[model samples]
Target: MQSSRFVIGVIGGAAAVVAVGALGTHLLSGTQSTTGLDAHSTVTVDGHKALSGDIVAGRAQSRYHPLPWVGDKVSDVICPTGLKAVAGATVTCTGHRSDGSTVSIPVSVVKASADSVTWKFERS
Candidate 1:
């Protein structure tokens, strides 16, 4: 009977540890959106930090040098606002994974089309 009680106590302790671990992960995760981007918007490349003029669904890529990953995590490339951004214009976006980490990036913009901006994952 004593041995059975000891075994049960060990199991209970293990379960408690697991619960604490899960709670810690939830608290440490950064706050970012996993939802896809809008149909029309500007892109910011972390590599070059260049903000090109507005682009449409089908357009040439602007200048940028990509690093692929930052601090071991995929980062969202962003262009600093300046060219013609104004208040109420959501030129800035915060991207991330389901846990709120940067995993995707917007390499270009397609104002009124379905064009996808390229991130040029491979650096030349």
Candidate 2:
């Protein structure tokens, strides 16, 4: 019947509109892609960019290893207690140098992988 044809046409039109909307959303979201980073890499943290260094794995658990620096040179870094290195988490890590000086680096987790986590440093 003509009514059946009309109902089918309406459904098809609605499906087309939904498909177009989904495609548009995907295209727009692609512009916000992130800068890829991994473990043992250097990223900016609170104006002081440094390497992520190694992770301290103890009893089947893993965490970012603390860094050690010599004088003005960059070295190890440590995040505060309870601030996990998961994606979207913000943490302030203290950079330790050999000369007994410490610097605070504000970092935000961007991506967390199986073996490493990437962070973006925030400017003070």
Candidate 3:
């Protein structure tokens, strides 16, 4: 009876250790981190023609500065479908106006990729 009890206790302790180890590994692996990044959306900033002007989207807010520290609402654009404007690829932009003016603009790719990008104006 004493030997049987010892064997059972050893098994239970081993199982608990394995479970804790697995949980710790999963938490430290960083497989569930997002950092609020939307890689599927394209990014646009100010002075970028075509995408410039007043625009709005989710988590997209801007504040302009004219004086020492003035803030005004601006616009930002997100592709959400990824962009193909690579080092050699060309970026074609279209301008939309509620009035009546169609502007077709082309943006030369200075630097681009498929993973991530930075938008000076757009946040998400």
Candidate 4:
């Protein structure tokens, strides 16, 4: 009977240690924020013209909010004016997070034409 009790006690202690370890890992991971936007897509434009900063910023914000684990953490996105509607053009945009931090988002025009422009947000 004593041996059986000892074995049960050891098993219980090990289970407690595993439970505590799992809880600690979960708590530590909860404190971290995983907010990022690495997206690319095409947008339709009216004519062969430069892309507006507002359009770019709006699109970035829209794409970033629905991302899993990010979920509106980035409140806004700001881009420069006069983004050329031509392939190979690049710009750096700033993403403002809810924590009052900013992230650099690089935008590049991958494909462009008279009626549409495909842009990519490069990882930074």
Candidate 5:
């Protein structure tokens, strides 16, 4: 995580108000973890259970939507197929930015069960 400082100044008649604020930033460059993800939308890849690429991409897009700088800039997310849902499984998704550039989003599976799976976004 990174930190940034912002200053807001309000000037009025004979009075001045200045506010300083600090925010911890993720900026799509930090690790974000999520748990208990629904595993219903899954498939079998080489006899192993795997999450759907489309579903993972959609979920990743939703996760990126709330980010500060890269949220609004991302137009779409594309993940590779056959992402195993087992523990320690990893994949790198691509985020297409509005400016025609691409961002790499690495993901790792933390846990997996019949009903749910937990995954985390690796720091870029």
Candidate 6:
């Protein structure tokens, strides 16, 4: 009977040690992590938003590509035909105004800063 009690006590102590170690490791590792858009977006330059009166500059390929123009909200606004808008790539975005007029605009993805990409717009 005494031997059985000793074995059980030893097992319990080992389990307690393991649990403590796991908790300690988890606490040391930390639980705070980046989430949402900040998790997927990357910034390669400085600044979050563009300054006023920034000129749009860049070049696009000849082959036409589909680029979606999202509204202020995440809803689908328009799908414009142009080059794919990538980091440091120039693309064209054609959108329709509320006045029933179509407008083709040149867009440039200059750089991303602080989880946001800077864009320049020009009339075409």
Which ten contiguous residues of candidate 5 have the minimum total lDDT?
Answer: 13-22
Model 5, range 40-113, lDDT digits (tens) per residue? Answer: 57777778787877777777767665556545545578887746868888888888766788888787788888
Model 4 has an lDDT value of 0.62
Tens-digit lDDT track for model 2 on 17-104?
A: 9999777655533211233244344454455433342231110011221112111333465554322346776656566545777666
RMSD of each: 13.3, 16.1, 16.1, 9.9, 8.7, 17.1
Clashing pairs in 2: 67-76, 67-77, 68-75, 68-76, 69-98
- Per-residue lDDT tens digits for candidate 1, residues 39-121, read 33544444322224333101211122112222233324443341222212223422333356543333322222223222211
Query: Which pairs of residues collide in model 3?
Result: 41-80, 42-79, 42-80, 64-72
In model 3, which runs have C-alpha deviations exceeding 4 angstroms? 34-124
Give the range where candidate 4 is weakest over 10 consecutive residues by summed lDDT.
31-40
Task: Give one clash count per candidate, in the order shown.
Answer: 7, 5, 4, 0, 0, 0
Q: Any idea how many clashes model 6 has? A: 0
Give the Cα lDDT of each candidate: 0.34, 0.46, 0.35, 0.62, 0.65, 0.39
Off by over 4 Å in 4: 1-48, 70-72
Q: Residue-wise lDDT of candidate 6 within 15-117, one digit each (tens)?
A: 9999997776555433122211233233222333332111121121111111222221111123243222245655445444456666555566555444444
Off by over 4 Å in 2: 1-72, 82-87, 112-117, 122-124
Model 3 agreement with the true structure over 1-124: per-residue lDDT tens digits = 9999999999999999999977765454321111112333444443222222222122223222222223232333232322333443343334332344443333333444444322322111
Q: Which candidate comes out best when scored by TM-score?
A: 5
TM-score list, all predictions: 0.35, 0.31, 0.30, 0.55, 0.63, 0.30
lDDT of 2 at 30: 27
lDDT of 2 at 49: 37
lDDT of 4 by residue, 27-51 (tens): 5333112222222323223443656
Give the Å shift of residue 62 in candidate 3: 30
